[model samples]
Each structure stands twice: as C-alpha cells, then as structure tokens.
Target: MKILAFSDLHRDKDAAWSLRDAARAADVVIGAGDFGTRGEGLADTFDILRDITVPVLVVAGNHDNLAEMQAANRGWPHLHVLHGSGVAIGDTAFFGLGYEIPATNEASWNQRLSEAEAEELLAACPDKAVLVTHSPPYGVADLQRNGRHEGSRAIRAAIERHQPQLVLCGHIHHAWGTKGAIGHSEVHNLGPAAHWFEI
Candidate 1:
C-alpha cells in the first residue's frame, strides 16, 4: 500500500493542505505528532484531519493529551487516533506510541515512557508490524547538538525485542529525512514537517 507520513507540523495548515494533496495519490496518510501548538492545537488539527480524503491515522506527541485526542476522534470513522494502539493497513499492522524520554536539550511534553509502558505497547503490537511513534529510538534517528544522538533507550529496547517491519516517528525536526534500523525494522523520522513515500 502507499502511505504518506509526516510530523512536527506545528499547526501549519498549509502543510496539512500539502498532505491532502499527497493523500490524493496514496492509500493512507499518517500524522506522526506535534500536530498542534504544544499539543493544545488538536481542536484546529481535527478540522484539517477531517478533510483528508483517504484513511488517516494519528499518534499523540508529547504536546498532545491522550484523552483530548480520543475525544476529538470520537465518532470519526476515517480518522484514527492511536495511543499505545495498533491498526491494520492492508498486510501490515501499525503500532503507535506518543511520548519520548526527556532529553538534555529538548523539552518533554509530560511524563516520559517508562520501561513497562514500552514493553506493554511492544507486546501488544503484531509480530513484524510497522511501528509509529512521536519519538525516535535511541542511537537510531536521534541527534544532539554537535551531532550527538539522543533517542529513547526504552524505544530501542522495544525494537530490539520486537522487530517490526517499519518504525515511523517525529519530534526532532533534524531527524527528518533520516532513516535508521533496529534489528530487522526500518525506522524513519518525519521531523516537524510533511513528506510522502510508498509502502
């Protein structure tokens, strides 16, 4: 299937418009996270999300509250909000998580993911499924000032323990356009912007 993935949009509705254009030619469109102004912008984001003509899946960023996202997606068939949840897209299963660990330079939205939460989510995912998240796994797509890497150790452990087909994430804008690997799974960082690719 063809899927268009993007992240860290920061409330740029034009980017949403551009994504809609990409959705015209793809089977699915996914918004990784940071879709709002510090997670408070879901109200506006929902309107744009509803306009997508194709199936769309979304994950909350540190900026987003799980309850708020759920309420926004209520009764929406085409829009899906996954928080430690999974969805099947054709032959692939997509698993998603929303939060990242706190970094020295980067700020976190709320509580970071604990080992237990990571493991639970990983265990819930289908074998060899596609993983979707708001943060990158450690030493993979993560980067630091002076080029150091700062991804999530818990996330890395989950990928190592449960090798999925593909992992998609965003949060660190610099990570955009970068790809990495964990076990047999390929991980992508869509950054705070939008982009498209074929699955």
Candidate 2:
C-alpha cells in the first residue's frame, strides 16, 4: 500500500489543504499529530483533512487533546483517531500511541504517559504492524536543539520487542524528516510536509 504520512501540522490550514492531492494519490493517510495549537482548532484541521477520500489515521500530539479531537469529529467518516489501539485497513494493521512522555514535557493538551504505561499500551500491537506515535523512539530522530535526545524509552522497547514493519512519529521538529532503524523496523519522524512510503 502507498501511504501518505505527515505530522506536527500545528494548525497550518494551507499546508493541510495542500495535502489533498497527495492524499488522493495514496491508499492511506497517516497523521502523527499536533493538528492544533494548545488543544484548540482541531475541528478546523479536520475540516481541511476532510478532502481526503481514503482512510485517515491520526494520533493526538502534545498540542492536542485526544478525547476532544475524537469528540469534535464524532460524525466524520474516514477519520479514525487511535490511542493505544489497532485498526485494520485492507490487510494491514495499524497501531498508535499519542503525545509525549510526561516527564519530558508538560502541556494542557499533551496526553502524557509514563514509560511503563507506554510499553503496556504498545504491548498489544501485533508484530509487523504499522506503529504510529506522536513521540519518536528513544535516541532515534529525537534530538533537540540542545542536542539532547527526547524520545520515549518504552516506544523504543516496544519496537525492539515487537519489530513492527514501520514506525511513524513527529514531535521533535529539529528531527523532522529524519529516519532511523530499530531492529528491522524503519522509523521516520515526518514533519508537516507529506512523505510517501510503500509497504
């Protein structure tokens, strides 16, 4: 399947709209998160993404509220908000976890989780499935401006244990567009720009 993936939009309506054509060309659309600013305007982002006809899978970012995003798009078809869950589209299984580690950062909309919690949530993911997360795995595409790696240890553990085929994430803007490997899985920190991948 051809997947058009993007992340950390942060309420960029123009950039969101620009993804329509790419979405049309892709089999699936995956959004890592940060659709809104400080948990507001997610509906507006959804409105723009509504142009895509294919399945759209998303995870809430540090700037978003997962419950609010789901509530705001309650009636919207083709958009699936995933958190500690798996959704099957065609023959592929997609699993996701949102937000940053609580110990790393704090924000009103940031759905923070502990390392153990993240590992427990990811434990349910099936092997070879697509892992979508708002935070990158530890030491992989998670470098900050100060050169510190801000990533989830649990996420990295899960990747090492489960060996998912692909991992998509976006939180560390400085690390955007970067790719790394964990075990045999490929991990990408997709920025606001759309990235194309075939699986």
RMSD of each candidate relative to the true structure? 2.3, 1.2
Best by TM-score: 2
Total backbone clashes of candidate 2, pairs 3 or more residues apart or in separate chains: 0
Residue 133 of model 1: what lDDT? 83
lDDT of each: 0.75, 0.89
Clashing pairs in 1: 8-192, 39-63
Identify the leading candidate in terms of lDDT. Answer: 2
Clashes of each: 2, 0
Task: Residues 160-181, candidate 1: write the lDDT tens digits.
Answer: 8779877888877776888989
Per-residue lDDT of model 2, residues 1-199, tens digit only: 9999999998898889888767889999999999988878887678888878799999999888788878755666888998899899999999999987635666555568898888889889999999999999999999999999999999998899989999999999999999999989999999999899999
Candidate 1 residue-wise lDDT at 82? 81
**Which parts of model 1 have CA positions greater than 4 angstroms off?**
102-111
**Any idea what lDDT model 1 has?**
0.75
